[model samples]
Target: MFCFHRLGLRAAAALIVGLGIATSARAEFPDRPIQFVSPYAAGGANDFLTRLMAQHMGDELKTTIVVDNRAGANGVVGASFVAKAQPDGYTVLMGNSATHGTNPTLYPDVTYDPVKDFAPIGMVGSVPIVLAVNAKLNVRTVAELIAYGKANPSKLSYGSSGIGGTGHLAGEAFNAAAGLDMVHVPYKGDAPAAADAMGGQVSMAFVGVASAASMLQSGKIRILAVASPKRSSSLPDVPTLEEAGFKGLYFAQWYALFTRAGTPAATIEKLNGALKLALARSDVKKAMASQGADAAYTTPAALNTFYRSEVKRFGEIIHRLNIKATN
Candidate 1:
């Protein structure tokens, strides 16, 4: 009995030691380089912002953060990769409006749940979508465009990045709100859509600020109104759709950081803190401005709540429009 008691005591001590080691390991959180996955092609807004944020976050965390581009299937490829990654803080995804907000409704075979499959770190910022027309479309303001469309049914056609994209939804929403009958012209991508719009192939288009920067600068297209609630600093002269006498057309492009579900709360807080620090830097703000994006950040809880609302909002739009993803 004495020997058994001694052995039991030893086992308890070993168990305590093991628990201590596990706690320490959890506390060590980002002891090694982190892999930041950008679920889009290189040179796009998502990739650009991810690289910049990774650099700044790496600086704050005092560790290396490598950006891995996993572009395909309209962001599902990279999103799935991150969804299946370990719950450790080492692997994270740069989630945007499509991945966490609308993909579930758009794609019938989405592999992960936006709210359940990952832990939201925090929001990076919002990229505003612009409603632009060809330079020589002969329409100056939203009112004029509406009047023209009303007079000529199906004469006013708008282009989008692709079918069922945010741009398409925005155009449809705009048509419904303005009481106009405008046709939607889907292109393969933003470049071609905006290009055709600039060349007068289409009457107008809903374009991301980042993708429309050059077009705005080169006088290729004339912006009618911004789709966001507030006007973008990049185009201070441009008015929001509300300011242009059309309300409830507030569509935002949300970008944020996220990790797989089951990540430790402490680790999520640490990453959120690092992201806040990086977003507050002057250089980071400048980069965002150059890309026609705003520097915005939110707490983890706030992000989770906002993400859910976005998913619901966009999901409704997708359902009502009957938009389906091809891939």
Candidate 2:
């Protein structure tokens, strides 16, 4: 009986040791390097924000976060890749308005549901869209641009980063509001669209402020109005579409962090905490401002709600405008 009692105690001790090891393994989330996916090319605003957040969040998480650029299909390729990634919190997506707000509706065969396939981590920031015309056009204000478009329908065309991006939607909303017939030209990215706008290839380009910032300095591109509720701090002198006589029209190129759905709630919380820490840093905010983005953060739940609403709102706009993806 004494020997049996000792054996039973040893068995219990072994079980306790095994359980403790399992618990430790579970707690060591992100023991390996995490992959941060940017769904755009390098040197762009999206990539810049991705690297910036990765640097700060990685420090807070005590791990190396590698940025992987998977640019294609107006953010479809990278978004789909992250959507299908393992739900282990190691693979995260720097998704934006195109990925979460409009792509699902634009691409008929989009592989993932924005709301269902991803767990919201938090919001990063937003860059306001702007209506910028070539300086050669001599258009100085939104009203003048609209009048010119109406007077010369053949001469009025607008370029956007892609077919279904916020820039495209903003341009279309402007067309509907001002009764203009500007042709829509879709570029592979914002730089090309803004470049063409400055080069006189298009009458105007509906692009993010960052894409047009340097060109504005060169005196080649003139921003007519911001496609947001208020003037962006980066362009304080510009007025919003509402203030320009087009009320209730607002658009911004927003970005956020998301991981594949079904990731453990604790892991999501850890990522959110690190993201909040990164966004709170003054350097991060200043860097974002320089890129024409306002540094912002939201709780995971709040982001989830905002994301859903964006999806719905963009869907209505796409449907109304009859916007379709060319490829």
Candidate 3:
């Protein structure tokens, strides 16, 4: 195992003491306005979740929680901002697996070290993506879709959120495991990708729950299979990809809270509390449920462990796929 030098240990202790001082310095954590940054478009799923959590967190922290949209470079822009921000408690990042886990493998020159540069605050929850078919496809289950793809081969195409986003990786992972080659059609975002699927421009898509939930409910698109280990609570009737024949083929994207690596420990603890409480609220749970999202919570340590595993897993996949990072 690797070990830290003497000076490094002292620095860690000072950081902890500093956090304690910061806590005592203020009556509470949110004595000032808090800024939460989302590394995606203003209206995407990441932005939506950050907004929802901020509203509830505002109530608990007894201060305004401002959400800033810094969309670009597949969430790299906002994440880089957060990585370089002051280690103080005021600035926080809602980091997804795309930036934290997969980017390292995809980008040959990763800007931020996922496990080193940021402190793991807490996990928001998990979102299971679905393999959805347009109403025109006439394919409804995973079995039928596989058979049709095999017969037609490259004739069928599917859309993804972006080239290296979690939604995109899910589709690629499916294709790799199933040994089938379907033309991959990339889009700017999940909304547009879902739009193409609904418009019959694409035969099917592997998209996040947020973009496809309403369409699925209204019968706009037929869900072939949910890419999760278990059936989603919101769509329990929909079989998992494993149940549909591709056993152990599960892909879900989740978000975690973070701050610069040198952030105050007390502030981190305070933020973790707020996250747990916000996720517990009936309103957040209901909102997530409507979006086919589950309200799961985890402690800071657990979140860190999870983050490490995800980083390792996605690192392997991205390297194999030869995805090159832009920045």
TM values, all candidates? 0.90, 0.94, 0.87
Would you list the rank order by lDDT, best first? 2, 1, 3
lDDT of 1 by residue, 1-327 (tens): 999999999999999999999998766778899999999989877888999999999998999999999988778889999999999888999998889988888887888888889999999988788898988868889998888888888788899887666788888888888988888888866777888888889988887776666676778789888998888888889899999888878776668999999999988998999999999999899988877779889999999999899889999988886666652
Candidate 2's error at 114, in angstroms? 0.8
Q: Write the per-residue lDDT of candidate 3 for residues 9-81, one digit (tens) a residue.
A: 8899999999999878866566799999999888666887899988988887888999999987777888889
Model 3: how far residue 136 lies from native, Å: 2.9
What is candidate 1's local distance difference test score? 0.86
What is the Cα-based lDDT of residue 181 in candidate 2?
83
Q: Give the alpha carbon lDDT tens digit for every residue of 24-112 in model 2.
A: 88776779999999999998889999999999999999999999999988788999999999999999999999999998899879988
Clashing pairs in 3: 107-325
lDDT, residue 223, model 2: 90
Predicted candidate 2: what Cα RMSD to the true structure? Answer: 1.7
Off by over 4 Å in 1: 1-27
> Which 10-residue window in model 2 sums to the lowest lDDT?
146-155
RMSD of 3: 9.5
Task: Please identify model 2 stretches exceeding 4 Å from their true place.
Answer: 1-9
